[model samples]
Target: MNAAPPLTPAQISFFHEEGYLIVPDVFAPADLEPLRQELHREIDRKARALKAEGRLENLHEELDFDRRLAAIYRDSKENGETIMRHLEGLRGGGFHAPEMFDVIASPKLLAKVGSLLGTGEIVASSVYRIRPKLPNIGRGVVPWHQDSGYFSTHCDKQLIITCWAPLVDATVENGCMQILPRTHRGEVAMHHTGGNAGFLVIKDENLPDDPRKAVTAACPRGGVVFMTNRTPHCSTPNYSDHIRWSMDLRYQSAEAPNNVGLWPESLDAAGKADDAFYEKGNVACYPPEADFLVQSRLHPEQVTNYAEYVRRRETYDRTQANFSAFRRWPESVATK
Candidate 1:
């Protein structure tokens, strides 16, 4: 594999000080084509299955990739909830598909990540998300929250990076990510479950004193934005007529202790045992899914393959019968 260009001294310093960085054109069109094809294939399969169940009247085959899902939802009297559900099936640690595995395991991408992490041993977190931001969909608009807010306190001190890359041009009108600069230097702000999607969001009172400092991270296809786990970021509603396709993948030091393959054990704010939160065989983390080793210098041969990735995911899916009952916060939390 060709060596990825290393980040400049200034770039590394900026990331440390500002909490996020945007690297443009990290992957070429040819590199992204496979993932794109896989996404479209998944969409087509879902559409067909929905049609077979008489949930959709038409497949919207005439629409282009950017507008097909939107068109399907717009035409369906059910207002696309079914379509959203199908897409949600592809979110969070949702890399069971071969195309997804290829994308995350891209050597070029991992090299860029390795530069920031200062290590070649990288553990790809199973907590990645594939976001297809459709126009005006509640779930498509992610609320402002730190990624660490959803994680167990056990991994608090570890450095886990989030790399968000768009498959299409992410513009202001298409709901590109907006981030508060330098927020990672601070503590994880208090968050509550609220917003149209009912996702976790930092309260307005906790927002940085200067809202003007927040900037929209718009970039072309294949450009990637890297952020620390504690950075405050969120995407706005997609006002455009098309779907804003993007993927958010995460990486952590392979040496960090995480609940990747093991069942999630609840921990208190101090990272100690919490009996109430512990379940006998529950998975860990929000949207608990299996993690895998993407890049490893110590044990390169042990890195997970496409088949192993699928097996771990399938095993979790089957064993996580009560996964939905898990909650990060109490029921008293207001979501409006």
Candidate 2:
């Protein structure tokens, strides 16, 4: 794939001033199917594991595909560790999966991100999430909160940008993501634990409305919605019969500090020079004993992939300078 087209002056201004910008057709529809297939496979695997562990009685009958998977696990202290460990694996802390790079370093998508940051050297650090709307369950309303509410970074500006992409036709009826227009320009809200599920938190107030209603991001599959880390957004609970799946990616500057203490092996063995933060923050959220197997399963290649993705992106910058037009659309459109 070719590097993405540079952002228009208007798009850049919108992103900086408003804290978000949406680009249409960042990737061809065809590029989305492989991801869709993988998502299904991963969810299926999770289902099987949950069933085996007696977390669920049956995958087909009891698994609520509409509920956000992030909130479905048991509300135990270990639950937080389980989620973090899984994220560490998927977001360049686990196996060397190309899909991780695809989402983080996608040539087309990164250009838009680069345009917003005003830099070509982009560092992507994001979570992979799935919203499985099960039948008959409330698509819990996600309280208003900025993505940075959970991040450890301390910058005057927002360091997190969320790329939300859905695998199905997202609609108001099916619990699509909702955003409050222009609210990100205000003060960053204080967050506390929310009522949605285990450990999920949101701001204390509902968004104010006057002339406008909450904008529902209901779009066809393969379309992407870009929002600021500070944007107050949430989704209705899915009562739909089908599963509504989507992924959220995080990106930052290569120079930014990352709390990657979770990846112990990624640190250098040599006399801990210049890198002491990883070990300091890498404390396990789970109990001491539960960490043995989980940490062992973590592969160091994930850290390498993230570093390399940044390097390869520079090669793409040169190519971007030469190319001026977009590439052919992907094949998913034919099916649509």
Model 1, position 7, has a per-residue lDDT of: 74
The C-alpha lDDT values of all candidates are 0.75, 0.51
Assess candidate 2 and give its lDDT.
0.51
- Native-referenced Cα lDDT, model 1: 0.75
- Position 321, candidate 2: lDDT: 27
Candidate closest to the true structure, highest lDDT: 1
How close is every model to the real structure, measured as TM-score? 0.87, 0.64
In terms of TM-score, which candidate is strongest?
A: 1
- All models, RMSD in angstroms: 4.8, 13.3
> Quick one: how many clashes does candidate 2 have?
14
Once superposed on the true structure, which residue ranges of model 2 sit more than 4 Å away at CA?
Answer: 46-96, 203-213, 259-336
Per-residue C-alpha lDDT of model 2 across residues 20-79, encoded as one tens digit per residue: 665656777788766655654555566567668876543453444333343344333243
True-vs-predicted CA distance for residue 13, candidate 1, Å: 1.6
For candidate 1, write residues 27-97 as lDDT tens digits: 99789888888777777887898888888878988877788888887788364666555455543334357
